[model samples]
Target: MGKSIFISLPVTDLKVSVAFYEALGFRNNPRFTDETAACMVWSEAISFMLLTHDKWRSFTTRPIPPSTSSEVMLALSCDSREAVDAMSQAAAAHGGTVDINPVEDHGFMYTRDLADPDGHDLAAMWMDVSPMPARS
Candidate 1:
């Protein structure tokens, strides 16, 4: 298995994207963050590479999709419902838009989705482990 997962995303404005992720409580990993790209670490095993449009283009010859036409959504899990709400609120305060309605509290789980400054779909979710059925 891989040691970690690095999800690379193209951002129209690197600075704005950095701020957007920061608002969601992600810390910048200096080891991988610089002028060309900002590394947003969600966990020890998960990291998001926010690449400038030009820098991202270098990885592929195909044209990048416009933010409006893209439909990719990145879902991240939180420890509790309050964390989910906190992330959504932070996103809005940092200029990111709430793309979905507030937490759909299903008792065992809660979910909310938001769009970053560059229109990247991001979802914050919380799950109650105690309520889940036991695995056989």
Candidate 2:
């Protein structure tokens, strides 16, 4: 069997967070969703479990960071440069903040970073590895 990753995040508002994730192309898996949490599917191997504050605390007593602070950054691969840009636009249109860091452009890859409404850092990127230089 293949392994998969399930990222758990604490959100202030369940519905809004779900919508934001959806805009970025994640689909809600109702079988794993409820009033307190939602399983947002990005692909066959990737999924995010967005949990309400109370629901989050049930699993850990660790303090939830304030909206202005970030502890980690998540990166997603896009099919093309246009897909990366589209995700940036979608993020801005939603409650998310787009381009938290300046855009990065290398000949083989392009990236744009954004932050969710709750301040989770997310990076959308597209890369062509064919031209990448091999390690010495």
Candidate 3:
């Protein structure tokens, strides 16, 4: 079996966070979802566990970062630049912030950043590997 990663994020509201993630193309796996957490599945190997503040504290002694600060930025790869843009729009419409960063276009790659309601940072990116310049 291939390895998998479970990214756990501290969310203030489980339902809203689940909806926010769903708008960004993640599906909830009911088997691991409840009032305190939602298992948002991006793919077979990538899943995010959106946990409530109390639940999150149980796993770590570190204080939760304020909404204005970011501890990490999670990036998801899209099949096309249009897909990245679509996700950015969806994020905004679903109560997330899409103005965290400017849309970056570098010929072979494009990307944009978004912030969830709880201010968890996320990025959507698309790359055209066929157009990548060869390394020296």
Candidate 4:
């Protein structure tokens, strides 16, 4: 079987988190979803398991860090710079907070960052792989 990656995150509210992700165009995989968790599939190989705090705690001894005080960030890639902007805008419309840093235009890459309702830092980025001058 092909290898797969599932990023499991502890969410304070399952329904709210699910709705936020859905607004970002992700689909829920019912096969792995339940009252305590929701499987959000970003792609065939990349999935996110939004587990309730209690269910998440069961898998670890460390305390679940409050989202507002956490430092972890999750970055997701898009197909183009426009897409990065679009997703970030969608996040803001869905109650997510956009970081103060202005959108970055690196010529070959573009990026914007946002924080979800749970205060999880999420970044939307795009890389232009077309031929370009090498950086000094």
TM-score of each: 0.90, 0.96, 0.94, 0.89
lDDT of 2 at 94: 84
Question: What's the alpha carbon RMSD for model 3?
Answer: 1.5
- Superior by TM-score: candidate 2 or candidate 3: 2
lDDT of 4: 0.85
lDDT of 3 at 63: 94
Q: In model 2, which runs have C-alpha deviations exceeding 4 angstroms?
A: 133-136
Worst 10-residue lDDT window for candidate 1 reads 96-105
Note the Cα lDDT for every prediction shown: 0.86, 0.95, 0.93, 0.85
Candidate 3, residues 1-136: lDDT per residue as tens digits? 6999999999998988999999999999999998888999999999999999999999998999999998899999999989999999999998899969887899899999999999999999998898667999
Whichever of 1 and 4 has more lDDT, that candidate is 1
C-alpha RMSD for every candidate: 1.8, 1.3, 1.5, 2.5
Choose the strongest candidate by lDDT: 2
Model 1, 15-103: lDDT tens digits are: 88898898898999999888999999999899999999889989987777766655677889998888888998999998788756465
Q: Once superposed on the true structure, which residue ranges of model 3 sit more than 4 Å away at CA? A: 133-136
What would the TM-score be for candidate 2 when compared with the true structure?
A: 0.96
* Candidate ranking (TM-score, best to worst): 2, 3, 1, 4
